[model samples]
Target: MYMRYFSRLMSAMAGPRPVVFSGPSGAGKSTLLKKLMKEYDSVFGFSVSHTTRKPRPGEQDGKDYHYVTREEMQTGIANGEFIESAVFSGNMYGTSKAAVQDVQAKNLICILDIDMQGVKNIKTTDLNPIYISIQPPSMDVLEKRLRDRKTESEESLQRRLNAAKVDMEISKEPGMFDATVINDDLEEAYQQLKQALLEEINVVKKVNMSS
Candidate 1:
């Protein structure tokens, strides 16, 4: 019995998990996720998304996003390659199942930085994903962050801010996410996120044990 228990424990420790981060633009989802990747070597930063947006300065293909043309994306969609796809601000974004499988194959936890709509699509899949919503400390701070980016025009910034308000309200809805972290203090937020991942893994282990 002791050996059986030890084996089970070892197997559980070796297995990978899937984590999802959902939030609106300028909510610091990407920033927090990038920090987590740097701090946790075991994490597999899933390059799950393909986008129509041109790579920003210093952004590398396959590192930031798989850059694709509109025609290629349409063909991929026709082939049912993506688990979810969405268009925002005239740019196309998609998450491919192949990307998730690539991470799982390496026995590392796959983390996705996705939007709220993409989260809904992921829920429909067989993957048992743990969702985390990264929120700004306040709308004022969120606006400031967006403006500081200097990547958008005034009209676009206003649109994003308006969208963020709606996203925050949706995040507050029951069953929308497993956990929420406010990216006000970077260290504190990262700590909370790490703790939440451990807690979810524990819950899954308990479930497996009972079964």
Candidate 2:
């Protein structure tokens, strides 16, 4: 009976896992993650981020992102509240340990939409996360999507395009990610992501059982 109860406790503690998504700007990573969240009943959506950027129109605090002032963000960093933080294009963004803990408490899989720096930080930490790279079908599609956004000036657009090129180069390196899914077809991409997640979960479970 004691052994059985202990097994049950361990299973509960293991709970849902965590996954990380990284990609270049306009790679459709966000869209694919949203779809995966909607489709997977077991997945818990953890808003694993806080940003210094002002919320866009219709964006809600805590839901879209934990909107914080730069001063506040700096303070948090000093306090070691953030698991990882980075500055991108003059904006600060980070994932807090509290944010990840909140999801872990509920036994839900937390998904982090992060950049390369954030990914590197997570790898060094205790959270053994599976990383996935969402890739655009082609540079043409990526450029078209960025143009459609209409939120960037000519200068800003050029900067983003240049960044995207660099991001793509880094993402293609061997051993960078467990899986890479091209976001050209939504349905296909989702299926691939789902399968990759299941495989990761299974590997974790096997390790747990063996241990």
Which digits, one per residue and each the tens of the lDDT, describe model 2 over residues 107-132? 56778889888888777665667789
Local distance difference test scores for all models: 0.79, 0.79
Q: Lowest-lDDT window of 10 residues in candidate 1?
A: 6-15
Error of 2 at 11 (Å): 15
For all predicted structures, in order, the TM-scores are: 0.85, 0.85
RMSD of 2: 7.1
Ten contiguous residues minimizing lDDT sum, candidate 2: 1-10
Off by over 4 Å in 2: 1-15, 200-211
Q: Summarize candidate 1's per-residue lDDT along 86-112 as a digit string, tens digits.
A: 888888999876787777666567787
